[model samples]
Target chain A: MSSAYLAAVGEDDSRGGWRPTVDARMVRLESAVEAVLEPHRARLAGADRVTIAPDVHYPFHPSTGVVTDPAVVGAVAAWLDRELGTDLVVVGRSDDRIAFDRTASYLGYDRLAERFDAALVDLADVPTRNEYRAVDGRSVALSVPKPLVESPVIVVPSLRPTEEGTAAGAVRTLGRLVTSGADSSRASVAATQMIDPDLAVLDGTVAYGDDPVATNLLLSGSAPAVDAVATSLLGRDVDADVALSPLLSDGERPVAVENPDGVDLSGVRERLTGGRLPPSDDTHPAVSSAYRLYAAASGDAVPPQLEGR
Target chain B: MLSQFRGRLTDPKPLSIGVLGVGNIGMVHLKSALAMPGVEVLAAADAVPENRDRAERAGVDRTYDDYAALLAAEDLDAAVVALPPFLHAEAVERAAEYGIDVFVEKPLARSTEEADRMLEIAERAGIAVGVDHTLRYQPDMVGVKSAYEDGGVGHVPYASIIRLNDGPLGRPPADTAPPSWPLDPNAVGGGSLLELGVHCFDVLEWLFGELEVRDATMGRTLEIPVEDAATVLLRAPETGTTITLHCGSYQWEELPEVNTRLRLEGITGTITNRDHLPKNFYADAARAALENVASRVGGEPTVFGPTFYLRAHYDALADFCEAIRANEEPPVSGLDGRRSLALAETAYDLAAETVAEDVEVPEVRP
Candidate 1:
């Protein structure tokens, strides 16, 4: 079983409470995901294989469960197949047995990929480069370049860094995959171990201050830049200790996010490489990287590695 | 030592007047010349046969189709050239050469060159030439001049003359086909400027002394190609005073009642006059208006009036006849006519250059 970890963050509604109610956070997460993804299903028709990463649940916001649940992932895949006329595979990850037992009966694990032209990869541990590359090529038909391990990969930080660092596990894994040439396509196909993925996504909805997977902090507001700026203004380093930790070496100081409040993310999703995600499950790292790439390509910024990435 | 050189009117002798052309204006002169003291309607000529018949019906004794035959006749003492603009020079020259005193209609010739040649011939021949700039003779104009001279209009700061009328006496309708002669630019020289503006130009000069136009602007407002309206500004080179005139084919319905206003601004006060009234009327009106307003405000009226009016046309005509009889120069001689025409021509030229510039008539120095 190949599984994926997905993290979601949302705002806490409770006053003078240690944590926000899970039911309220879940509704907000569901609404934001639906708002972001429902309108663009027709535009994301190429993908065939997909995995549902379990949401990194925290006490700050309950909406974070959407990101951690495989049921929601399967539902989104089914929706993409029906609406966009594309096949998608779905897999789930969860620490709780109740969720898995209840969702497994309704989820067609066998026909999840074949009936909808999709597949489910059940994993017991973190994803390796071979696993990701095989699934990406065979399912999504992505021609990732060989030597992607040596290619410059940028990492964007979410607003809140996880206390335990498990919340941004996807960013670290993506960075490793690129460095190992798992997502690359240009190398001799026979010699190439697997294609390296050059991009990563980090969710900062219910971020953790000390240990993200355990101590949840609702920091959802505007775009990723807004949260990053707010956290920086609060004296928290985003790149080194938050979602951007994967791109930093030891003792590497994080740079401040510029004009985070003034950044207009109105059409950010359309200009992004991947389709837009709902606010509950939005990949802040992905949005920021895409923004930096666009800015650099347009000669608006100096030729330096973008901050946070 | 003013000698009374008035001709004797002992008996009403038939004035031997030769009509050069029986056109509308010519016919008027023909009729008027015949009615004058000691006048005889001896012979008449017209290029058109219809005009000759009209002249005959109007009591011309003999009618000739060709003007040359009429000029050749030795019986006439005076001759009137009522031909189009182009024929004026030749007719006037031929009449002068024949030892006949000539009354040439307005616009002496089609060009300044032709006018100069005709005047020269008349001068050399010692024959009297009277330009029918007839507005100078009108009753209202005589009054305006007298009022201006008597200080009735005080210093005469502004003098405006407006002579707007319907189409010229016998002008054909535009839709009925253009006139063969008047429409011909070569024959007519220019349009309303040469034809009718000549009258206003002469009248202004006569009233205000020699007028030097500082600037002028002209425009065409009618269907015809001629200039229908002209605004002129005049300046007295010595006095440094100014006058303006706006004359045109405007006010078609008010053709018969031409309006003129001469305003004078003096060190003491101001005076204004309209139409043709005796100078006394203007002086009286001015003094009364000023005094009545002053007295009502508890101030005394200082102005008084017994104003005079100038009746100069007959006197002007008598001067011409006396010049002919005494073989002396007329007061307003051919040079005077030429000078006025030259000023008028210059005005037209300036008007063409600055269509909106104010036209000022040049003043004559004493």
Candidate 2:
């Protein structure tokens, strides 16, 4: 009965994949967002306080399709405030790498918050409640933030692959907001169940496959269901993803899109499949090994960047 | 060994060196010194136990928890001052008291005043002070200079240099905790200008001669305490060239593909650093490795091969060590470091003035 909706907006005529101008991208994003959310508008109208959790783990330039564009969040906020008349909070968490508030500011969420009369909350600063849930037959405990627990949550994650070689979907985006005693996969499942977000809106205006691509589309549905579709689109086997395997039934057919329009789903899958995040270590292991071997032979000091590999 | 050279004695032995604060870049200096011929890495100092562990793994004979202790305990020709900017002054002063020459990492001190005091002490103690301004040592920059000097870009009227990377908060997958001092204004004195712009200032001067800070602007992409991005307009009076230098820590950088671009719009044509860079990083690295191996077989000097960017650090340290051995001023001396700091300070001031001028005044009440 669950279905993910896809809506394409703007022209895609450029030889090497067309990217809409900023104005065109925004207009199209809002149209796509409106179309995707049309099916869930009834539930959205009933919510009082709604919090939008986004893939804002770092202040990576939004144009790279690495992080959710704040413009999309702004458009979503404007529509929610106008149509649903709901109090909104744009939520993220501060980790060791960067503060969520700083990341949001860099991604232009501060102006978005001001323009939409929304609160920019760092989940780390919020009070948390301990919740225990069983994921994959393992007991997982999560210290989920109060704002996310008490509000109607809408997860807006960027279309990208995580370092663990899985789609960083709505569930993982929500999981990143909480403190978990479980491993990443288990933690993501537990947090998603505890939060039970009302909607998952993917910011696929730009997507990071092997590289950034201008997909210029938005898709929305149930958080876990949408993530299942995202998993397939990212060319990942659901059984291979620890988070998706436990959460989604193995026999569940490929999530059928409610409205496909003139979009090329197979083309989208082909372009985004087999994509992975860039290496986050000091240097590649092979390069390090080669450098060390070379250093031994040449009696040259190994560069520190090559050390500790 | 301790009594061999009580203070500045001419011992025919190879230059014995100590590395203080073997963190990321410090480790690079430590390893570079370790690999250089006729130099000994006597000891290394770091506050972090993990860093000391890394230093040991890199073959340092002795390690100290504090740099002051290392300076007090070791017998060495020079020390590499690779501590944070706040500690740079103290580290240099300690080296000075022990009559040990120093090669410090960039942004020589937190400010020009602190650098002046450090340089004065080094001068009084008769110790050489070398600053690791490694841009000049980089092959691409060197190639640009060589081409410019060769009149390949005849009478360049304008030039622009851009250097950007994901600053303290590096790009995802968010591997390590970014050090806090880099973002704190008091701790580091300034942001990208001091951390990265200083390097540009040093390189610009090297390329165009004395540069005059014209108009400037600084921006923070985030609400962090310091500006993460800076753009400065400069005029090189000697070369009669207008230059724009923009540096930021906001861009995401994946290695082997650095985002440093240098372009010269000359009277004849455009000359770019890209023209000299290796077509393929890994291929060039492999070639460098093979050449170094061949050199080893031939009993010739082995250049720091494999990485073009890292080779500069090696060459810079090698130059400093050679300068100390010859009892001469370092090629990139303390004064050169101070000069870059002065230029950055001017840029900051000019940027602040621009901001003030742009501020709108309120209408007078009736």
State which candidate has the highest TM-score: 2
Model 2: native contacts recovered, as a fraction: 0.57
Model 1 error, position B194 (Å): 1.9
Cα shift from native, residue B283, model 2 (Å) = 3.3
Docking class of 1: incorrect
Task: Indicate the residue-level lDDT of B115 in model 1.
Answer: 79
DockQ of each: 0.00, 0.42
- Per residue, candidate 2 scores C-alpha lDDT tens digits across A148-178 of 8897889999989999889998888988888
Question: Model 1 over residues B65-116: C-alpha lDDT tens digits?
Answer: 8888888865777777778878888888788768888767777776677778
lDDT of 1 by residue, A1-309 (tens): 111122222333343222333334344445334433443344344543333322322111222222333223433445555565554433332323222222332222343345456544332233433323332234222222222333222122232323332222334322322223433221212112232222222343433332222222222211222323333423344554333332233433333322222322222212221211122212256644753454333322211111221
**Model 1 DockQ (Cα-based):** 0.00
